[model samples]
Target: MSATGAAPRRFRHGLVVGKFYPPHAGHHALVEAAAARCAAVTVVVAPSRRESIPLDLRLAWLREVHAGTPWVRFVGRHDDHPVDYADPAVWDLHCAVFADALGGESVDAVFSSEAYGGELARRFGAVAVDVDPQRRAVPVSGTAVRADPAAHWRWLSAPVRAWLVRRVVVVGAESTGTTTMARALAERFRTAWVPEYGRELTARKLATLRRSRPDATVFDVTWDRDDFVEVVREQQAAEDAAARVSGPLLCCDTDARATALWEERYLGSSSAEVRAAARRPALYLLTDHEGVPFADDGLRDGEHLRAWMTGRFRVELAASGVPVVELRGTHEERLATAAAAVEDLLAAGWAFTEPLLPAH
Candidate 1:
């Protein structure tokens, strides 16, 4: 098929400016639209110190989202001006900063979704190109995402979504349905989940032991402090990697905090490294092992250690200062209870997670 339409309005350069506090799908669409019309485009991420999300993270997210679009480049700097979006003086200062930021580039067009596009364009001696002013294609914004990230989760890119995602760590003693619950919750929410990394490492050690002494089982090998440290490191890395692909909420079978408990159980004490690696989870779903039948996979100690381990987990969690909810019932019932708690956390805007800075 031959081309029938007129060429897109070509420009030497185009500019898109914003804090991009948390870039959404709409911002991406606008950047794409600008790139389609211009030879080159630069996205300005002007963030202030007052924002919760830092400038570097926002810049990295923009780069990730627009990685394939080579013509689209990002230039970020701190916006030191006061928070006065409606004031003309503020706009003038932004224009000066934007112009200074675009050193030698000839910006002939400015793109935006807000009404300020025209004024921004006039300041740069460029034509204003408004894309999705009504936001019909992507009916979402940074404000909406910040207000309720879980509600507008679909609109966020992977990296940005990961930043806002809260992990609901399913942690407890052995023989519980932590893995099963994590998988089910991930499937239910259509997101990613982190499996217990310590299990895999322990399995590897057991495999080596069997090869060396064919009669040995997983439970025969005793782990040292370094082993526990490695487990904590691997577990935290897995959770982080999973969160990048997870939507708004990450379902973690176990977290570093659990690794700390396991270390205390096996090694008689927890390592400082393991405890430090433990991140504060949005919610902890403690699966009670009472009704659940204890099944040994040759790795876990028998039901005799369940009460002791569960008690230690409770004590450790209390000291670590993470929210906990003790779940009791069948697998399905536990899932329902966990799902409700997660919903409540999201509804409350994740008040449990501490902020980067304390409020006055």
Candidate 2:
């Protein structure tokens, strides 16, 4: 409704088209405007096949960001046609792709922020609606985002932020301060952190055993291949959920790779499925168990095997080829070391591959 008490003008159907190299706030604004002005809006995400970001991923991110708007539909199509604004033949090729994506649906309006919006509307036989043509509403561009994602991070949606967040997993032997380190790092960075799901599962298993045998101790808490698989799946789900809402850096107490090693500690061997679930994180902070006195926390039973497990983690991490930063000395020292490594990581910045460029 307007201030004059008149209903807002709307069209039956509107079309929005973009490469969406990676959908930033500007792209979202265009779609939102179309959605508000049209009864139904179709957003055509047309990226070239040679583009770095996948078409499906762009579509998924857009859908996630605009989930509240049910009237907006997103479609992905690979438009590898050469981009030449002055070439009519090239424009025709691109329009053909966009038209095919529409599936014979008539568009009453074309909403865009590009100079080519009028031509696009003419091709679709729809009215041209320019939206934020100067980029004032959302002062960001895909090119700027691609060049340095961290600089333009504020303009990105949660899903896109999750995709760009640098995940750092803290893993080590029992009672080695992995949780403590992970928590401290999250606090230092003012970001979200994922707790070890396996620990919660352990507590649950112990409680379940107590129902049958009240005297069952941590020693009696048995595990199998399926248990490890469940831990891996839940751990990854938690990490992903945290990443979406986390700052540029996400800290984790442990990860699926650590779970595989734990599986070997209990079940005597890690399964192919368990090992396959391991994902390479941006960095690994291994808390050394050297001077840390073992305190039996009811759930921990690996006091004597701490040295062996630490060695195993070191070997596995080294073999995995992901960069590892071992934390030793007092808790404060370890935190400093981890923080320094993280600072270096953030300093490196994100590097997205260049998308398909328009012909000169």
Candidate 3:
């Protein structure tokens, strides 16, 4: 309300334009400000074709982050036009792209944090609303994020963080310390770890069978191709969920590739659908079954097949072309080895292709 007790003015529609290279808190702030002052807001996510991140992915991330704001609509436009702040022709070309994305609707206000916000607003015949022009609010930029995403991880939303998090999968035969290693690594890093979905499914299957057969054991728990596919899908979904809340590195007991191998072991072969679901993680820690003692935990029946499974994992992992580090010896030693590998992966850093630059 105003000083005179009048309600605050609100525009019919607001417009926000940005590359949104990877939407950060600052971008969210700008959009939020627009939403607060407008009946409806349209966030135009304009990125060049040469940008590393897909335009669709940018739209999805922004839309998810602002899902609660039903009035805020996110639209994408591929603007390959050369960026030249000094050239009116370039401005016209870019505005044309933005206009087309909005279906030629009139913009009531142009919200931005850039120096050219006023000019852009003038082109649209809308009011110029500067939002944190000095970056005092969020204190971050896409350039800084792209340079070191780990350092700017907190500024990113869950979906963007999930995409940037380095995933390290710990895979091995039954009772070979895969879960232990994964949990320990997560603890060491003070991050999140994904448990084996297949194990949980196994327990569920056994419990369900016992209700009908009274004497169902782990051996009675049978698996079909659909089961493996479910495991693959659930495992990935869990990993993605964990990544959102995890630190720079995420630990996983297993992944879809491991699920594919499990499918082969049970069904005589892995199906193409299961195989296609495999996502390459940043690192794979294969726990050797040689020194580990197998314990029949009422859910495992692969003691005799441990060595064979280990061999198969090695062969498949080698063929998959993902970097694999074998963890052997005592639990302490294995944890240390896995920790070092994770540190190396973190040190290697994320490599994002540079976005197109404006003309000098």
TM-scores, each model vs. reference: 0.85, 0.92, 0.93
Whole-model Cα lDDT per candidate? 0.81, 0.91, 0.90
Number of the candidate with higher TM-score, 1 or 3: 3
Candidate 3 overall Cα lDDT vs. reference? 0.90
Per-residue CA lDDT of model 1 for 6-25, tens digit only, reads: 35577778899987757889
What is the alpha-carbon lDDT for the whole of candidate 2? Answer: 0.91
The collision pairs in model 1 are none
Q: Where does model 3 exceed 4 Å of error?
A: 1-9, 212-216
Backbone clashes in model 2:
0
Report the number of the highest-lDDT candidate: 2
lDDT (10s digit) by residue, model 2, range 1-360: 011133556899999999897899999999998998899999999988877788889999999889999999999899988889889999999999998999989998899898889889988888888888899989999999888787897898889988889999999999999999999999999999999999999999999999999999889999999999999999999999988888889999999889989999998999999899989899999999999999898999999999999999999999988999999999999999999999999999877766667789
| Residue ranges of candidate 2 with Cα displaced over 4 Å | 1-8, 211-215
- RMSD of each candidate? 5.0, 3.1, 3.0
Q: Rank the candidates by TM-score, best first.
A: 3, 2, 1
Top candidate by TM-score:
3
Residues 223-275 of candidate 3: C-alpha lDDT, one tens digit per residue: 99889989988989998988999988999999988888888888889999999
State, as a TM-score between 0 and 1, how close model 1 is to the true structure. 0.85
